[model samples]
Target: MSRTAHVNRTTGETSVDVHLDLDPDTVTVDVSTGVGFYDHMLHQLGKHGGFGLSVRTEGDLHIDAHHTLEDTAIALGSAFAEALGDKRGVVRFADATVPLDEALSRAVVDLSGRPYCVHDEPLEMADTIGGDYPTSMTRHVLESFAHHARICLHVSVLRASNPGQKPDAHHIVESQFKALARALRAATRREGDEIPSTKGVI
Candidate 1:
């Protein structure tokens, strides 16, 4: 079966569209969200996960990036869920640890058709990365994605920065996204022709 999905969402605060193909003939990423850092992160996600993904989002950036980031994640997560369908023949559980420069992050995922998220990070992350993308929104994005995707996700920053140096929000956040991407790639992999859960429906 082809694993692909598209989602379009519009609201008073934002308009978002996402297309995802878990098993694509050619992996590609195209993202435009008006937030440079967030776009870069999404690119990393698609590239590292070895999937084809695209996203276009227009939000009230004059107000903040919260709406755009969260809404985009919602759409992307919905697309992921739709692409997986009934989650048959999937690995269903995986974990990854990634490091970017001095930052190290870990992510664990379970495609158990349950929506839950646990995000842990240092309190001293840089305020923002690309001026418009706030570091705090990272957790919100993960939470929103997990909820919409109906997956159990856990992400943590094992190391924030080099000793005696302040946390680099860019590296910290990038590591988290990379780890999540890798974990998702593994968890979504085709393993066998059976649902991973004992319930036979996940």
Candidate 2:
């Protein structure tokens, strides 16, 4: 069976489309969120997760990137959940730790049909990275994705160092995304033809 889904969402602030294929033999990513940094991050998610994913968005950038980022995450998460269907045969729980230069992050995931997110990071950067992507929206994106996907996700920046200097913002964020991607990929892997939860469904 093919685990794939497509989602299109439109609101007064943004319009977003996402396509997700979880069982692809090779990873392919195409993302355009109008914010360069955000696009880079989404690409990392798809590439590291070993998924065929695409995302496109049009938003009121004249205002800000908040709506664009948040709505795109919601659409992406919805597409992922739709692809999972009944969650049968899935690994259902996984964790990963990833490092990028001086930043190390960890992500844990459970496909429990309940929405929850715990995001902790000690990143100090300018209000925005790449001039348009707001640093504050990092946690918001994770929260929105987890809620819409109905998954329990926890992400933490466990270590970051620059030889007594503050950590690099880009590395910190990228490591978190990489860890999340790896965890999600493992959690969604097909292991056996059975639901993983004791409740008989997830």
Candidate 3:
């Protein structure tokens, strides 16, 4: 069966749409959130996770990127939850560590039908990446995604090669996203026809 979902969300601050497909063979990705760096990160989520995903958003950018970023994540997360359905046969738990140049990050995921997030990163950024995407919003994005997706997620930047120097914000965030993608990919994989939970539901 095809695990797919489409979601549309609109508020006074933003309007967002997301399409998600968990089947690896149907993988494709298209993302536009009016923030270049954010779009790149979303692309990494889909590509590295082996999910077919699409996202489009329109927001009051004249104010800030917060609404756009948060709403996009909310929509994407909802789409993922909807596609996952009862989460039957899924592996349900996974972890991954990814490295990018001087940055190393780890992500752990659980498809527990509960919303929670714990994100930790020590990198200090120059306020914004490319002048539009705020460096601080990275954590907010993950928190919002996890809340809406109803998944337990934990992300941590374990190490940076530049221990005494300013680490590259781009690499730090990118590695986390890559790690998150891999962990989610593994956690959502189909393992059998039975639900992976003691309660017989996920």
Candidate 4:
């Protein structure tokens, strides 16, 4: 069976459409979000997650990436949750750790039927992330993604004390994406080539 999902979301302020494909050996992505930063992040997510993804977002960046970012995350999460359908043949758990210079982060995910987030990063850059979008905004975007994905997500920054480590925002975010992607990749892998549930139905 083909494993893929397509999602579309629109509001008065923005519109988003996304596609996802789960496969161990292939990854394809076509991301076009009005928010350049967001587009880059999604691209990294697809590359790191070991999946094929295509996404497009048209949001009121003229105001801010708030709605656009949150909505995009929600749509992508919804697509991920839907694509896993029944969670059959799914490993259902993933984890990864990555670093960019002095900045290191780790992320864990459980494609469980639950939505939870554990974010423990500082607020030093709450207003500016790599001089792009606000770190707080990224945090909220992550929350929105987790809320819609229906998965347990935990992110921890191991080195948040280096005052001078304003690490490349794009690189920092991409590293996080890579870690999340690896974890998701592992969790979604089929073990023993069998469905990972005892219910024999997912």
Candidate 5:
């Protein structure tokens, strides 16, 4: 079966489109959301997760990036869930830890057909990155993605502080995204022709 899906979502605040291919012949990532940092993050996610992802979003950015990022994440998650289908032969669960400079983060994922999220970030991290992307939106994006994807996701920033330097929000956030991508790459792998859950479904 071809594992691919496309989603289009439009609201008063934003219009978003996402395409996902889980078993793509070649990885391709294209994202344009008006939020530069977020675009880079999503690129990392698609590239590291071994998936083909394309996203285009337009939002009322004069107000803020909240709607754009949230809606894009929702669309991406929806497409992912659709592409995954019944979860047959899926690896279903995985975890990964990644580090960027002084920052270290970990992500755990379970494609359990249930939505839950636990995200922890460093308190000392900067308030913003790339001038416009609010650091607080990181958790919101993950939560929205997990809910729409019907998956359990846990992301934590294990270390982001240096002895003399303040925490870098960019590094912390990038590490988290990379870790999440690796975990998702593993969790979404096909192992055999059987459902991973004991109930014979996921």
Candidate 6:
């Protein structure tokens, strides 16, 4: 199916639009915004999800990545919700645990007509959980994405092998996305092309 989705904010702060098709083989993402960090995160999400994405943002990034990230999730999630149509013949559940040297994380999804996010992941940098790096904001984005996408999501960091493990924030984020991607790919599949739920539907 084909779909289009959008998200608009009140602060005149953030706005995003997403166009997506689940069956595309080569996902193309063209995104530009004032926030570099957010751009990286979006790339990770798209790449890991095996999704081709294209985004353009005009936000007040002098403040931070908050608006950009959250808005992007809103749009992307809405697109997924729109595209799923009736959630027919889908696997509906998947799980993945990803490791970045000392840091490891797990994410599970249920496209079962509801949205939720649980993050039990570990972070090596204070930048991840605190500072402007807002872990809560990231979680908010995840929750918004899943909720609107009509999917249940759970993310956990089962281990962080060492604090001295990796010095780069990019590595930390990349590993997390990689893990998420693997899990999402599995969940989106049509197992035996069967409807995974006992209700005879997704």
Top-lDDT structure, candidate number: 1
Ranking by TM-score: 1, 5, 2, 3, 4, 6
| Per-residue alpha-carbon lDDT of candidate 2 for residues 42-160, written as tens digits (9 for 90 to 100) | 99999999999999999999999999999999999899899999999999999999999889999999998999999999856657889999889999999999999999999999987
**161: Cα error in model 5, Å:** 2.2
Which lDDT tens digits does candidate 3 get at residues 1-202? Answer: 8899999999999999898999957679999989999999999999999999899999999999999999999998899899999998999999999999989999999999999999999756668888999989999999999999999999999985575778788888899999999999999999898989889987
All candidates: TM-score: 0.99, 0.98, 0.97, 0.88, 0.98, 0.81
Model 5: per-residue Cα lDDT over 107-148, one tens digit each: 999999999999999777678899889999999999999999
Q: Which is superior by TM-score, 2 or 4?
A: 2
- Candidate 1 vs candidate 3: which has greater lDDT? 1
lDDT at position 175, candidate 6: 64
Q: Residue 101 in candidate 6 has what lDDT? A: 71
lDDT, candidate 6, 1-202, per-residue tens: 4433333433477767666555567776656655666666777666767676666766666777788777777777887787666766666788887777766778888888867777654444446532345654656777778877888888765655555554455455556666777777777765554566777755
Error of 2 at 4 (Å): 0.3
Deviation in Å, model 2, residue 14 alpha carbon:
0.8
Q: Give the least accurate 10-residue stretch of model 2, judged by summed lDDT.
A: 120-129
Show where candidate 5 strays beyond 4 Å.
Answer: none
Please give, for residues 27-132, the per-residue lDDT of candidate 4 as tens digits. Answer: 7889987766677778878887888999988999778768888898999999988887777767787788988766778999988777998876655544654344
Which ten residues in a row are the worst by lDDT in model 4?
Answer: 123-132
Candidate 4 steric clashes? 2
Score residue 95 of candidate 6 by CA lDDT.
85
Model 6, global lDDT: 0.67
After superposing candidate 4 on the true structure, give the runs of residues whose Cα lies further than 4 Å from its correct spot: 129-132, 161-171, 192-202
Using TM-score as the measure, name the better of candidate 2 and candidate 5.
5
